[model samples]
Target: MSLKSLGAKIFAKIVFNRIQKWATNPVETQQKVFEKLISEAKNTVLGKDHDFENITSFEDFAAKVPIRDYEELKPYVERVVSGEENILWPGKPLYFAKTSGTTSGAKYIPLTKESMPHHIEAARNAILCYIKETGKADFVDGKMIFLQGSPEMQEKNGIKVGRLSGIVAHYVPAYLQKNRLPSWETNCIEDWETKVDAIVEETKNENMSVISGIPSWVQMYFERLQKSSGKKVGDLFKNFNLFIYGGVNFEPYRAKFENLIGRKVDSIELFPASEGFFAFQDSQKEKGMLLLLNSGIFYEFVEATTFFDKNPKRLTIGEVEIGVNYVMIISTNAGLWAYNLGDTVQFTSTKPYRVIVSGRIKHFISAFGEHVIGKEVEEAMNKAISKFNFSITEFTVAPQITPSEENLPYHEWLVEFDNSPENLQKIAEFLDLEMQQQNSYYFDLIEGKVLQPLKITSLKKDSFQEFMKSEGKLGGQNKVPRLSNDRKIAVALIQIQPQN
Candidate 1:
């Protein structure tokens, strides 16, 4: 390693030591640390500015600031794109992280100097914690492949502006910069259309040890690797040690990933967004325990019960409870306050603050006027599949509304399975029964004649790839959207005939 790499290593060690000290502290101490950080943040943002005087306490700051979504930040984003000083931050944003949103077409989220350090810290803490648990840090020494977005810059009037991935690549530690498997500048081949081909070509020869990306993209890459080599993916990346994923849950694709790799790969979950890296799986031993970056952003949880009742109570980190779901709200250093991030999560424990991602607040089905969340669907499916002694490779549940007299909505399950089971009907019935048991709203709708019975379609193993390709969203950060709850999108997707 170079001198810069050595310095980074030393810095990482010091940071890791501090995090360990914090992790072992009492809840009271941790809370006090967070309280002080909140106070400092409030002072930093509101102190120098005349317009921000009303923001005195954290509660006052939250109450006074109107919640903002990505759309409201678009004008500031445009300013960053033009390299102008934006209202949200003091200086010009260092880079823009391009990401797509459900309603917003494509967003360019600003990553100011103040915000970048948080991302680095979150990433480092995650790494350090993984090492602490596994007693292995050199596992990353080999060729580590990241199925990242293309770093090609977009042009405005023939002048090239840097892409989000390019900016991240540029800013990473110089040691890491040297050891990056595919040189970002050269590896990220231009044109979104050719991304898969480029990725496959670049990774063919390397002894890739660790891989990171969204689950869907990694699955697609594995499939392509198998097809090209005429061998299983395990044969391709024989030296692979770990799999780090984010952007979506790995439940649906778990079996496929294990089967492809021929080993139980160590995995890490990241709750990263275009705006910031919010949370990460701190310990490898704990699957979904999210360690919140206490110093990065202040978090608030809207009580799940109140939300369903149409009256929500927002609670801070100090007030969160175990096993209760909540909508995530965040106030970040980058000028967003009490912003509803639209994701839902449930705390599994609060002593160290562990959480399981429940679903997106907007991505739940309200067919028959009774709401059902993505977590419910996942639970029902998992229980049902376990009962059948067969594992599901991939699946999606779409709510279909009938055009007949009743005009009722019914669920259609599209599943991909490894085994061609003799009793498919039994599996279907079990899944249907489990759904009713798990989601009372679903049961009530069916019993009241407001919704019809569940339907199942066994998809060919390669069907998801074809669907993704047809949509021009083949690889990198894209996933097969589970529980397409919206009436129109669900209808359109279910109506598509499976390719022969």
Candidate 2:
């Protein structure tokens, strides 16, 4: 091993022990975070508006500050955007993470000086934890590609604004600068397809070992690399061993990824967002990402089933239970107080608080009362694909309330296959059976004749990529929604279909 690799090994062990203190004292760590956030922001406008000076406990904070998503909190954000100080956090925010929103056009999420370290450190620790557990730090000596957005930033008011990935690109550690691949000019390519072409040209012969990105976009890169070099990714980058990803569940794409790489690589999962870094895979043996309790955020859980009720009960870490799906709410050092993050999670291990991202609260098919979620569909499809030895490029689930035929409403899965299966009929039945087994409401609906078994609609290859490009969200943090309540995305997909 090189000197750098040996140093990383030593650093990994030290970091592991430091983080273990917080993991063991989850409740106490969260309490300390809560107190620090309240104390620090008590004089700010949002804090004053919510009477934070008098707040002494989680109950007091909850009662004083109602939960608000980006849209609801935009008034304060707008003030900050227009150069106001102490509107959200203490003074002016260091930067704004610009991301596309659904109902709201573009969202500008603040990243404060106090909060930025949480995002950077958690990512670093994910690698450290992996190295410490598996005792494999040799990848540190080889080329690493993050497969991120353009690092070029545009000034919004006085703050630098860009995609979160792009903003983070500016912070690559000095040590890894030599090992990081794809020259800066290539990374700045505005167009994703053009960027991938540039990346292939630059790194096709490099000793790449670690690759990180959203699975959908990274798949595009792998396909391009294979097309150009006529070699599987594993052969092209023989040293490549670690795959890191977040934003979407990797299970659905596992088979396709293994085929592209021609081998299985050790992987680490992360649960991060524009607001804060929440969790990361700490142990190779663990099923869920270890929740960052001592990070600069205080977490709350509202039961997903009752989230829409007039008044949903918000529970802290002490009150959360294993296996119960909850909409994750967070109050962060970045000045977001009781913010509803729109994501749902299930605690797989509450001892040290490990969670799996279950689904998005707003991203589900509840057209009927079946209320099928992202996790259920991904799990059901994963099983069916594994059983049939089939692999898919991309897929999404939406309710088809108005079928072309006189049939009952059903969930329509638009799938883009890596290789078309010969027995699609059998695969459909298997997928439907798996879905029925997982969801009781869906099973009851099917038995009551209110809904038919799920149907698969095969899409032309690269349909999702084409869709994302047309929508101006081809790469970076953008991802196709896995589940939708309505047929908006489904209708859009139909329009993009090629005519014979």
Number of the top-ranking candidate, with TM-score as the measure: 2
lDDT of 2 by residue, 1-500 (tens): 88988999999999999998989998899999999999999999988999989999898988899989999999999999999999888999889999888787999999999989889899999999999999999999999999898889888789989878888888889988999988899999999999999999999999999999999989999999999999999999999999999999999899999999999999999888899999999999989999999888999999999999988999999999999989999999898888999999999998889999999999998888988899999998889888999899999989999887698989999998887888988998998888888889999999999999888888888889888888998988888999899888887787788877
Query: Using alpha carbons, what is the TM-score of model 1?
Result: 0.85
lDDT of model 1, residue 463: 67
Model 1, residue 214: distance off in Å is 0.9
lDDT of 1 by residue, 1-500 (tens): 54543444565577667865655553554356445445444443332332344555556645555555677656655655675553455555566666666676766666666777877767667766676666566655667777766766665322244545455555566656545666665457654346666667777777777788888777777767777777666678787777888877777667668777777778888887756677788776664655554555667788755765534566777788876778887766565556677788988766567788888887777756657777887887767656666666567777776656655667877776776567877877777777788778878887888777786777666566667767766665666667766555344444565556
Whole-model lDDT per candidate: 0.67, 0.91
Model 2 TM-score, all chains together: 0.99
Which ten-residue region of model 2 has the weakest summed lDDT? 491-500
Where does candidate 1 stray beyond 4 Å? Answer: 1-16, 23-51, 73-86, 155-166, 190-193, 305-311, 389-393, 403-408, 417-422, 447-449, 460-462, 498-500
Superposed model 2: Cα runs more than 4 Å off: none
- Global CA lDDT computed for model 1: 0.67
